[model samples]
Target: MMGGKGNSVFSLSPNPNHLCISMEDGSQSSEQLVVDDDDDDLPPIDDTPDLDIDLEEEEEEETRRDEKCFMAPPAPGMEFDSYDDAYSFYNSYARALGFAIRVKSSWTKRNSKEKRGAVLCCNCQGFKLLKDASSRRKDTRTGCQAMIRLRLIQFDRWKVDQVYLHHNHSFDPHRAHKKSSSAATKTTLPQPPLHVQVRTIRLYRTLSLHTPPTHPLFQSSRRLELRGGFRALQDFFFQIQLTSPNFLYLMDLADDGCLRNVFWIDARARAAYSHFGDLLLFDTTCLSNAYDLPLVAFVGINHHGDTILLGCGLVADQSFDTYVWLFRAWLTCMLGRPPQTFITQQCKAMRTAVSEVFPRAHHRLSLTHVLHNIFHSVVQLQDSDLFRMALNRVVYGCLKVEEFEIAWEEMIIRFGLTNNETIQHMFQDRELWAPVYLKDTFLAGALTFPLGNVAAPFIFSGYVHENTSLREFLEGYESFLDQKYTREALCDSESLKSIPELKTTHPYESQMAKVFTMQIFRRFQDEVSAMSSCFGVTQVHSNGSASSYVVKEREGEKVRDFEVIYETSAAAQVRCFCVCGGFSFNGYQCRHVLLLLSHNGLQEVPPQYILQRWRKDVKRLYVAEFGSGRVDIMNPDQWYEHLHRRAMQVVEQGMRSKEHCRAAWEAFKECANKVQFVTEKPS
Candidate 1:
């Protein structure tokens, strides 16, 4: 028997004197196969079991040929209970041998109540590379007629009926058995160790800070691509959605079928925004990611005077339409109640979007961004230091519009920047930037203390410089959020530890110390301490139900005063007009009002004065699930306001002494749960 082409034999010749044995009734006959040729290497006929062997010499030679050539079993004809089993057996054998096998044809008759089926065949080694890169290599079979066929057996079982063992090309079993870098072998990528994954997560975050998302590092980085590309990153989003009920993700595709924009916000962030969103800070200065898309963050000041990241968006452009679309999407998520005040860089697109989406909202420019421009404007001046100091004093010290006008004119004249384009532009947008014009707005002086400059919730300009893929940027975003949460937690812990001693005789101050967080309590303490310096001169109004008082603050260095109007109603709510606009901007009662309240016969802080965002338990987001969609218990801002009212009533009645309404608190909570359950249930 001569082997064909590279020791690959096609047939084995039978000996002339060899006896042909056949099976009868599914059982082999007890017949002996006689060896024809005088081949001493062949096993004796009587030694062989009762089996079909046309020629002993040929059979022995076949076995020797396989061993000599080191050929693995070629796609064995094995019995299987189903097509899947047959494929598994054949593929496993083929894999063990070098080279690949694929199905050429298959048939199935399952609908006819017959268990007849087969699937994929050997396409692995059939295709050849084309001369041209563009040319198709659809069929380049090696004419190796090594095929396996399966037929239906009893009880839905499939039995291998035919398996040919002829190949035109040779194979190396050892090399094929080992894993290969070919795409065919990589059906599933191996997962890295948990520790390695954690370390990679850190590396990904660090690299993201220095490179844009479209950089080569993000595309080819092994550590970042271990999760199997963009699909894996999408899976992460799905996982978040599955685990978190309040998480929302929205994406829009461009005309070329690419991602145009995306916005995501978790439940906690949304809840925080709903409570502290009255004074919003929108910043679009951070342009990051591979697409060079701007990172827009909506930030708000919490009760602690700390910045709270509300939500983030990535847009293709800073156009009015794009900003409008982004704001509308955010509004939909936040239940359509816009923030009362918006602090942002003086971008025309951003300004237009705010005016359209939140017509009632007070759109103010960020003082930080304004000062940035002022510095740039003064950079070319002869005496820049004098100009900067003059600018700061003009912007910071003015408490009235008239004072601001005088200071602004003097600074520009003194510094010879009267014709400056930057200053002129700022003057044109004076109401948007100057605190004097925006003193009535409840922004909590956020313009002075910009929230946009604080801890960013997602990928911001400071954290991303390398070009990165969308998937990698998103993964890095998760890590960034984790870091922010860790920082916030640490800050909260440190603030709690450093809570000042309640060194005041006012009962309301002591009550506030218990209800408010340490940071807010300390802040309110200043007002309590200053109450001693404020002298009230009350005058009865014609209405008779209300009285106006001149609260004059006569400190040794600073002399300031405010008008406090006390409504002589059972509710006991006081209104104050102060230069600082602390109550209007910060959501907390100003010092003058606090002094007036303390001076009055009031026993506790008015419920209306206590903002929920300052409460110790502001993190508890009240989410309610309903059918396919869900709604926040505080979906409508009024709901939160109503809850605050009830809470204040409870606190007012409970804080009569050290022993308050413990039972009443429990009852109120229980009633709230029951009401929520009923309201949330489908009608």
Candidate 2:
């Protein structure tokens, strides 16, 4: 049917049952045309066999395309028109690279229809379930960190702000090709160069083209250098997964297969972050574990004005790269939500890493760390009480920005620190530590390092401390989560069942008790109670509907004056602002603001002033039965497994005491009755 110049030429393939034949005319041109070879003498092929052959070729072609995709991966700053468009682009890249992606998480504003951002991730990004696996099929998920994050910039434009294309597992392009290549014939076909095959094999084995030898991640090295307590820690994590699949952890394996770094978070922490993730306090000075790894705690403030654990990381070293890796892991686990404010100690590596990783976040130095720096950097300032006093005044006692600047200049001049590099650097970064310069920045409840200054009420403080074993830390971490979530459950029960007695006869007080969490309501109650002490109000000025006044409050023997401003807008709308910035910092009104409200004859608290994060009745997607964020809500299998896990949790909790057991029994019976009635009803 075809000829090349003179003799009939057939395209050579290892498989003689190939469908297409290559042909060329007698012309001098070198192009060959492919066509179906309909040999009249050939025997008929069965439909099923032909389908099988076509499928075999199709699979082989797919495998080849997948291998080729490794050469190209998405980079950060890639832009798209919509969240779906960004997701589709990343999903195609994942498919082409022989992996799967899923919606890790996405967030929309409270009353908005469109999403603010979304985190699409590798399907295998988190840990695989360590539950009973005898009846389950093999899963390919090995906690791969490969993912792409999409952030909505503005007006329907989404940008790929973060991209991670490294997979911890290997993909074999030889799967289909090796199977098809078995169909041999007495014919020689072309093959790629030997160097190319070797290069690909090395790539498959190492996956370390950009990785340094010391931190050879996902390398196929059998030699392991796992240090003290790491094995026990790994076993402990495995045991945790056995109990609940809600815990996620990531660890680095060196070129020699050493486990030196790890990060972990649980379902409760993820759900808490969804609500209270605006301000983050990242601290690492708490512990030096058995392996000498620095334990970093990701902390957030709850509605209770208490520090809660968001995640924890044990790094290999204090390098900027290591912290960057830890930050990226935590961000990915939290669905790529960057905090509005980030607080940490003033370590150069940490500061640089925070700035680079969370570019949009306001990185503030811990007040205690700032003091420590001042003491160490200016050793002579400690010799004279006058010098130290002046420095403290500049750092802490300033009430206004102008006052702070004047105090700082006077302190530097009085101490003769004009040539000191540390003082100059501190002056350059004054906005990072000085509270006078940062009154506008919201800090939630974190004004300084939680562990350094305040009594750390977190359960971890009781269970974890310096020089602890990795296993001890993990065990304590798990125990604390169990207790913390139990506390939340108890508080939820109290909020739903009981209301606090009103300290004030105001209708606003009654509404607050119902709207706020019990702890937050108590904080509000304190402000209302203190309104009695706030007197001697004098109008400073008035313009349009707005009025500014000075209010004096008595605290002990000292009477402090505060600047308060209010606007009586149309429709009974009242706005209050205080120079104290109590609502801005603590998400609650100050006594001064409350006094202004009473003066304006406004009975109820402003609806706009009530923060949604402090609301008691809001439901969250991650808090569905207090479940993890890793579960794909759209997947029936994941939902069934999650529900089953929740049922098991009830069984475990009910075993704790007789009261819990009885209550759980009654609840289970009632639920079963409803399910049975539904099944019995006509469909």
- The top-ranked prediction according to TM-score is 2
Residue 285, candidate 2: Cα error in Å is: 1.1
lDDT of 1 by residue, 302-405 (tens): 66677666777666565554666577767756777788888777876568667778889888887777777778777877899888888887877777789899
lDDT of 2: 0.59
The Cα RMSD in angstroms, rounded to one decimal, for candidate 1 relative to the true structure is 22.5
What are the Cα lDDT values of the candidates? Answer: 0.54, 0.59
lDDT minimum window of 10 residues, candidate 2: 1-10
What TM-score goes with each of the models? 0.54, 0.58
Clash list (residue pairs), candidate 2: none
lDDT of 2 by residue, 309-415 (tens): 88787665666556676787677566677999998866676776787679999889877666656666777664566777777867656667888898888878877
User: What's the true lDDT of residue 28 in model 1?
Assistant: 14
Off by over 4 Å in 2: 1-226, 254-257, 287-293, 375-397, 412-424, 448-459, 487-515, 543-545, 553-561, 568-572, 616-683
